[model samples]
Target: MTPTKTIVQISSILEKLFEEHFEKKVEEMEALAVSGSDRRYYRISGGGSVAIGTYNANVAENNTFFYITELFRKHKVNVPEVYKINKDRRAYLQQDLGKTSLFDLVIKDGFTDKNRKLYHAAMAQLAKAQWIAGREADFKQCFASKQFDEKAIMSDLLYFKYYFADLQNIQYDRSLLISEMELLSKDLGRVQPQTLMYRDFQSRNIMVYEGKIYFIDYQGFMQGPPQYDIASLLWQARAQLPAAWKEDLLNGYISTLNELHVPRMDEIYFRRGYVQFVLVRLLQVLGAYGFRGLLQHKAHFINSIGPALKNLEIFLADHPQTPAYPELRSLLEKMSAPDMQDKYATTRGSEQSKLTIQVSSFSYKNGIPKSAGQHGGGYVFDCRGILNPGRYATYKHLTGNDEMVRQFLERETRMPDFMNHANALVAINVEDYMARGFEHLDIAFGCTGGQHRSVYAANQMAEYLRSRYNLEVTVSHLNEKKWVLPDAAKTEE
Candidate 1:
């Protein structure tokens, strides 16, 4: 489904859930920013109660999250409470944990004693969670697999290989690299599943609400070494955690685990696994940055590539295991060079002359589409004022590209005035940009569902610009994947 429609439909579902569970009407619902996931989060407030409502099409993952949250609550783990779940399990509402994440805390107060205590508090909870939940939580309830075993390890390694290493065109012995990765995966997989591993245990997932640190986003949690979670947090590239904090926190986590859990974990065994998992976690993230940044061209992910590279470099210099994977080591060292680093992350301004206009249609519910230009300059027209065909059952399933939907907007609504005024504003910008020898221009149309009015306006505007101006024009509907031609014929404005 289009993100616009997804939001529109899910909003009602969530509001109904709030009224049913909270025993009050939903007064306000605001979309929350999400990162690298299709899941939608919203801040829902109603009659003296508030909650965070979530929607994801993945039913299994949703059930797993709700199930795990219940388990964590039983063990008194510092996670938000899950309240109501839809019958099909595609949506749910949970306690609102507020917006202050641990990463936000670290960034605001760097290297302070207070922040040290907060980081330590985060470590303490992770220890309790891993020790208690690992044994008690049922592995049968996990979403994908029970363990972070060889297969899971290989998936992460291959992701790094294909998306990050291979996409960067890094010259490596592919067979040898794969062989080394397989060996590493098998070796690491042999570690006994001792405790609950918070697969994405990082500062950002750790929220500081009501002056206490709480964990969030454990839908990916599974049976694995506790060392993995520690590695995930301490080595998070964006956190820029001090070396002393890394050292102190590792020692502190181990200390807490042994002090709390019976049948105390072997410190020696943990340190060894810590090294390997740290390697695995870093490479996995590089792969994520590669796909989200390099392939998808997201500004946040693209900006993160350099710091990830730096983290890998520091590991190569310091870690003793660097020599074991000679082929992997060779690739990392080559990519670490200043020249190669620029090749992956630097902004490209190579094309200087030809003007290219990118027009997009999106939903206000999903936020605006970001401009790809370096200056972040663009024109965004709110098509909400134009009548929406999505409200009608006839145009409900059909997108703005459908001939009937186009006719509905063209004949039934004020879309012509909307399109005309939009074109006039953009035409001025385009002519001025061309005269100034500028290279790119971005224009977006946003409506309620990004389906009818905005989509139709974008298509009409794209055609209008193409006919009137001698320049390249590309159009897209940001919420949906299907690319359809404008069904109606058009002439130059």
Candidate 2:
């Protein structure tokens, strides 16, 4: 469900829970929907002046909410004071910060340039919260139940598969695509992980009560990459900021971070953070567009496709060196062209042309694979596989450990040969194994069921290949049937 509707549903549940908990009739209940990974909200005027309700509650999210709210309060960051929390019930009571969200302020009448200053001030408060939280934050224990580690990140990468392959019923080489993505994550890990990130720190989540920015909807805080919250604000899909204004806002954020005495804060970090933010937004937009448009029959997200792509295009153009640039560029180019629908159809080819690879008997102990399994006899094709070798290679190089991969792709180095191979082998090989040369390859891992083992192998191989060879790759799970590479017929001969 859309977050808004989910919040409303949760509010109804909370009303019932409060009535049962207090053994009193709910005289009046108003549900104020909030945003984030899961639907959350506040229910007002039911038997008390205030009550908070969260739909998806677990130990990690509950703790995160408590931790972030306490940290923000201690750091003098403006946020509502929690009264009582029924952690087990996913319900809480807190001070009412009035009903004036920054969303209303920005979109409402009389919102002036002065309001931008207020927004920036609110962001500054957020910066202060992050600075202080960064010091005492125990990332390992903070959101332990939520699994916000490498494994969780990998699961997020699978959303594309869920929406594109499973829901949309598109087909592509599952093993190869996944192998490509796993490699990307390792490079992503190189980014310094710090701070308790408020996964959705947008204007809507900030309240303008009592002339201060009061933080809310903060249940999903995590010890994660710092750029997440920063990116959430700057690249907010609903409130699209102009380029110049985004720059000003970013500068304001940096100045606030500096004033808060955050260590090693600079434009470089800001730029890096901004790139991460853009990448996240791109993923979210793609997922939302695909799900809403294709699955839910909601066309509004479809309309957003053009603008979202444009925003990503601008970001990718600015940061040509970002690991996500190649994928972002390919998606943007596909979406923006006048013949996008035609080109997309021609590129995906027919379902019969697709292949699925599975991995058999693979295990990982502390991020290193223990067993290198066979390809398990999946269909093999001679035709060039989907995705140009250059683009795949570029992504692989950007996401690899070797600094030279980054340098070559971002700077003056010539493109490598792996960019030319569409039928490359994609699987976990024993160290120094000589089954096939690692030069030009796109391998996929598949199992009999095409679900668990194949998926796991695809992920492991993708990570290994990206980290080892820095090659552009893609991964797919054949059973889900999501992605489709461009057809050779449409390519330039």
Candidate 3:
């Protein structure tokens, strides 16, 4: 693929920074995935160390991140350390916090005990950042807007209006909706700003490395009531945290804040602010997903729309008596109607009860297996890229599922990397499908012969999907005539 001009320019800066910082030549620079923002990230590995090289067209945002990182580090906030930045501030190098985002861990592990512990720790850290680090931050050095005041609040609400609701062409009294938004903004802005509100605080932006939680993408932080940050964390759409878990985390956050002794915050006051902010955050996120997914045609963001709309439904249903904004509430309810849901459905069978994921291993000679259900055409992965174990005499009789064959493939071939990439690809689709209530996915792996590489890859994928997603997964090996019991796919709802 041809590198874009901006990426090429950023790469040159990364090379220069690497040479100056480590006094060693750059060996490799690989562009990382694009994120929600315009910022581009590259992983630079050289001089026995790795760091992240980032480029963003928004120089003001870049300066805010640099300044906040420095200030927050002094205040003991857990953020990646900045190493070097370009003179123009278009690109910079920072510590690489590894690839395990909290979101990834949650999806892979499910809401496990250890994951909950990490979340509590994250909440504690968040409290400290909001209170201590927030108090010390230089407001003048803040990016774009220094505070999440009435204007900022209105911008987010209007973003939802123009980008999301308008794009959907939902019918509403526009003037009434605007008036309600004005009232809502005033109600939210009435609270005195006390802490640093991490505008985008959520699991995806939180990185877990070396058993520690670190913050990222926080340059958008602003001076606002801490409740905004709380809403951002607990009401995050994709996370889909249980209401009880949210309450526990919120209480823990409150306890941490009390320990800091910054100010006495009563539960009633805080809860009121928290609820309103949840509404605001959901609107902002829905607007973002609509613009990025529908407008820009990004698959990941498009996939996220269902979960976000679900969040909106839950919030709106819970608060039926919207005395502050009846028109706004009705508008949101109409936007999340069945017609709108169908418009954003990524695949057919998205209205089904439960999704069935069939994982099969087949030989190239025999051909790929067809999906069994109404929803046809799913993922077909070619696993022939790795070195073939079938070529070795010792492993000729062993299948990919055999313990010896599995170990051999893991050690000698690029099977682990290939499998990891495959897992990521399937995971993206599975998450979207699950959120949209899709049923049945057929994932098949093909190799030179189904007995070795393809069988092993298929078994791994089956186990991963079953454990990670708790979805109904059954493994079938076509060439070997080994098939899982038919009852294996009948999982409890």
> What's the TM-score of every candidate structure?
0.73, 0.57, 0.70
Residue ranges of candidate 2 with Cα displaced over 4 Å: 1-27, 33-42, 46-60, 86-89, 109-111, 140-150, 161-177, 298-306, 320-328, 336-493
For model 2, residues 141-197, the per-residue Cα lDDT tens digits are 455433245555555667755664344334455676577567665556556646667
Model 1 alpha-carbon drift over 4 Å, by segment: 1-5, 344-493
- Against the true structure, candidate 2 has what lDDT? 0.52
| Candidate 3 C-alpha lDDT tens digits along 165-277 | 89876678999989989988988888765578888899988999999999998988888888888888888877888888888998888888778886775779888778888
Please give the clash total of every predicted structure, in order. 1, 25, 1
Model 1 lDDT, full chain set: 0.80
Query: Which candidate achieves the best TM-score against the true structure?
Result: 1
Task: Select the stronger candidate by lDDT from 2 and 3.
Answer: 3
lDDT of 3 at 169: 65
Q: What C-alpha RMSD separates each model from the true structure?
A: 10.5, 20.1, 11.2
Local accuracy of candidate 1 as per-residue lDDT tens digits, 247-308? 99999987786788547556788787888888899999999987765554444665567777
